[model samples]
Target chain A: MSGRSHDIPEEVQVLAGEYVLGALDEAEMLAVRRRAAADPELAAAIAAWERRLAPLADAVPPVAPPDELWARIAAAVAPVPQEAAERPPLHAPAEPLVPWARPVRPPPRRIWPWQLATAASLALAAGLAAFALLPRPVPPVEMAALTPPDAAAPGFLVTARPDGSVVLTAAAPAPVPAGRDMELWVLPKGASAPASLGVLPASGMRMVLPTPPAPGTQIMVSLEPKGGSPTGKPTGPVLYAGTFGALSP
Target chain B: MADARTADEPTALLRQVAAGDRVAFRRLYDLQAPRLYAVALRITRQGPLAADAVHDAFLQVWRNAGRFDAARGPAEAWLLGLVRYRALDIARRGGREVSADDLDLPEPADDGPDALEVLAGSRDAAALHACLRQLEAERRRLVLLAFVDGLSHSEVAERVGMPLGTVKSWIRRSLQSLRLCLEGAA
Candidate 1:
């Protein structure tokens, strides 16, 4: 930011340029986006570039999409009807509607180098004084970074203690809309369903779990209705997820 | 395009889409999907992924159409941005990067001055097309390949056979110059 070029900084200009040219990977894009959101000048620069380069799209030849493509899009975008606060169904449901979704491994995520770099910058900046506050990682104290599959930036970092307690800390949390809350879920090995691990603390929180999870257990955060998902299962898309692993040596 | 509606129809259709008008949404998809799909296809190089990008983009447009203020830019530009982001993401998620040489499709025949001006109908598009024409040939090609084909800085450097630093500088300069030209033209 110091020793700037003209009025705006050179690195920011480069960021806006990279964003427009699509030269940046997700991690860089995310970093620029976080900045542009707060800085109007950067946003204006980006918008101008988007407008200027938009015409280049004319050169691309239009190809017809598949016949059923519209159907798929329509189904995906249909608004989820709001639940009635007071009125129960006229007829009692025959059974509980707990959907048994197979917790399939999500597509391999693209963790951009810059995203890792951002997190590493934080850890390095903290140095020893910060490390003094953090618990020592012993044989049973494992940590994991929970990054959502669709995320462009960093995600939450969690350190699990051998005594079934965990400290969940937010790195770059995915934004949740108003009237919505982020719910954490744990899918332990050999479990048929994901157990609710309470809401993710905005900053960071330490909570004792009923049992210590095994290594390699997957952790997920989903955007649920206000409070949490009405159903026991995830009613919304899983925004961020990552598996548990040993702390960095 | 098939219906001979004015260029403004896309903006109108998007407004309707925001209101949950399914039929209007269908027409919007019919009108714009091909171009969006083509953009995605160019970047993803796979039919399924390209289709997914388009589908995801349209859904995003439907959900966020209300946020589209025509005053910002054209509907086509807005929609194209969505699809372009989606396509780039798909390419990255699949760990698939296609160099210029690896592409099997023929390059856009009009990779020169007035490449975009001929099709431009809006003042912004026309201004941009003119500004692009002012850039040097190599810088323009770099911009096109990077934006259109969704190549990264390193990929563009390898494709253009230039050093990475040179590519970055040219792109940064090209962007600044283009912004200046467009503003002056306006």
Candidate 2:
């Protein structure tokens, strides 16, 4: 910050700090995120900032979560039945969650540091790809289907153009109550607020987003009052949502 | 050896988690969930949303634990970062039905140690806190508002009754000063 560490530009340092601090607006946040994927220096600066400021989190007092919370997490992370047969039982924890007090024992031999390094590097590579950080040319047109959780068929198809305009087409007339209107919202990656893209007409509509959302950004529709959310944010239930790049035929 | 192992507890657990060790995953959950929940709660300002953030973050930990690079940062920070990002996302989305139970929850305490004092309390953070203390009180508070409370630049400016441009400039300068001071101390 003061003296550039590692010759990182002052702009990059400030941007990293702002990104870590969650200060950048949606557009700026997305730009920083995109830059960090391919920019090792920028990523390192961000990591360094995260390390320096992380300890300050100790000041936030701990609060006990609901008793049911653990069970919910355990169930959510539990392997599918087929996968469960191949691994240890997730539910019954005979061993303590924290083995810190137990007498020292030889380390588990299954995973070695080198092996972990390999996995970490592979994961990092995969992460870069998943974030669409590759330097490949941008696809002119991208699309995703927004589907309800219970329904297999996509309720809406979102066609996003390079110009940051999105066309939302509903498969069926959207089921809106007499006085309610459905609104479209884009939750850009790393952005603090979901920017409203305006209300959706029953059949289909096209609108321009301030910027095209990144691949992992969430697109959602919430049922609002007769008009879109009175406050700039979504007020009603998120009736449908999907990741931007996760297209379905 | 025991002390060293204890220090590496979270890291070891994370490695096990990467290998599909559910027991270690649960243990790690037991160890870190409360602290993470507190972080989520602070940022989202809603209990249900906080719970959702922690829940989602832990699932990411379970699935992507292999991606954790020890050399990049501490295991705890890696974990906290996940929840913080999730909480921020939920907060930004804005309106969801507030759960009836959340209505009875106590509001977060506004008066606590300022950023410097909070950092000063921890051994790891003490030096960083000292660096932070070197900044003017107002600039330091701006840093705290942005980081801890998860307020955006405009929100911080509004709270402090300053122009947005002035607030942004002050925060940048303050961060640079902290970084410089910490580097000198090191």
Candidate 3:
């Protein structure tokens, strides 16, 4: 361990202490979070504050949570099933190809006026094919609903289009700190790296996010200390999560 | 059944909770809930929210039991931190923002003697509580904020209307003083 000056600066220690106590404003809070992610020393300092202050819980009397709360939390935390396993099997007609069939050959012909017209039509078709191969914009589609894990309830509705733009409208209000921000994450099944959609507005009403991943991706909300995750992945507890399944064509 | 032995040491119970022992967690809860609840209730001054704070705090302890480091602090401090953080989080969310004027310090209860009395029969707890009592008023408040209200130094500053710098210095000096006091007692 480094000396108080070198290992953990006294100023940063104080900042970490304040952070653990919930004292910094939104901006200072964000700076501390970023520092904590990069600096293990600062994190340890904050953790120390957590330990020192943890004993004060002795002041309050304990009350059991409602029986339904645990069940609700468990349901929310449950993992969502992926598509390959859940999709219905498709039954389609199959065509058989023959190996011994004779190949048809066209007769050698002169270039006539009608043949010239036919050549022009073929050239036009090739040009159209080239045009089709070029990149084009995909239109956005409205995201209908986000289904919670275990099919317990629809927690939020997302409206998004092909342009990579999305809007998250919470069907129910979520508890969020006044100075802190809620962050949205897309947790693909079995994936450890949760893609951050963006910061969620605390109002629990409506907020727009950058382009989301394709449908059937699991969406999660975490109570970030402030700004957003200093690390790209979630470092806080996930508050709510649901999967956005594909809508019928 | 023969005379049941009181599981005197908290560390043993904490070890069980760490191992996913629900029965142990319940016992731990039964052991610590009163004090934890009192802490939350004092800060928030709302019964239902205080209950929520306790629930959230215990749930966190259940989930993060493996993260406990005995070298950093005792089991009681760690659990208190959980409840305090949860209560502070609730406070920041504006669940119930009671001003200092609104604080109603309950009279010391006379319910068949207090926790200190029961623990005084034991050596370690008695020594620890005695050491804690030796801290100055400001330092004691800081400890309470950290353990009971779950207020970070910044939150403490906001609640007390002091500058962040002053609050930070107070907490550090207070901790240092408490450490010295505990060492002397030990």
Identify the candidate with maximal DockQ.
2
**Model 3 Cα lDDT, one tens digit per residue, A1-249:** 223324666666667666665554456666887889999888778776665434333334454432222222222222224542354522111212111111111112211111222332343334332332333322223355554445555556665422223456566645577766777765543343555645666433332221123334567777776777666567787777755545524
Error of 2 at B108 (Å): 4.5
Q: For residues A66-170, what per-residue lDDT tens digits would candidate 1 score against the true structure?
A: 543554455344433344223353223222221111112221222211222233233322342233223432243468777777556647777764333466767
DockQ of each: 0.25, 0.29, 0.12
lDDT of 1 by residue, B1-186 (tens): 855475889999999989877778878888889988988888876554576678778878877999998876779889988998888876765434323233345654425444554446545467777778789987988888788788888878888789999998898888778766765766
Mark the regions of model 1 whose C-alpha exceeds 4 Å error after superposition: A1-14, A79-249, B1-5, B98-124
What TM-scores result for chain A when each predicted structure is judged separately against the true chain A? 0.43, 0.43, 0.36
DockQ for candidate 1: 0.25
Clashing pairs in 2: A97-B27, A192-B92
lDDT by residue for model 3 (B51-100), tens: 56676677677677887777766777677667655666556555454323
Q: Output the number of the TM-score-best candidate.
A: 2
Report chain B TM per candidate: 0.85, 0.88, 0.60
lDDT over C-alpha atoms for residue B63 of model 1: 78
Which 10 residues in a row give candidate 2 chain A its minimum summed lDDT? A98-107
lDDT of 2 at A197: 55
Error of 1 at A68 (Å): 1.9
Question: What local distance difference test score does each model get?
Answer: 0.66, 0.69, 0.52
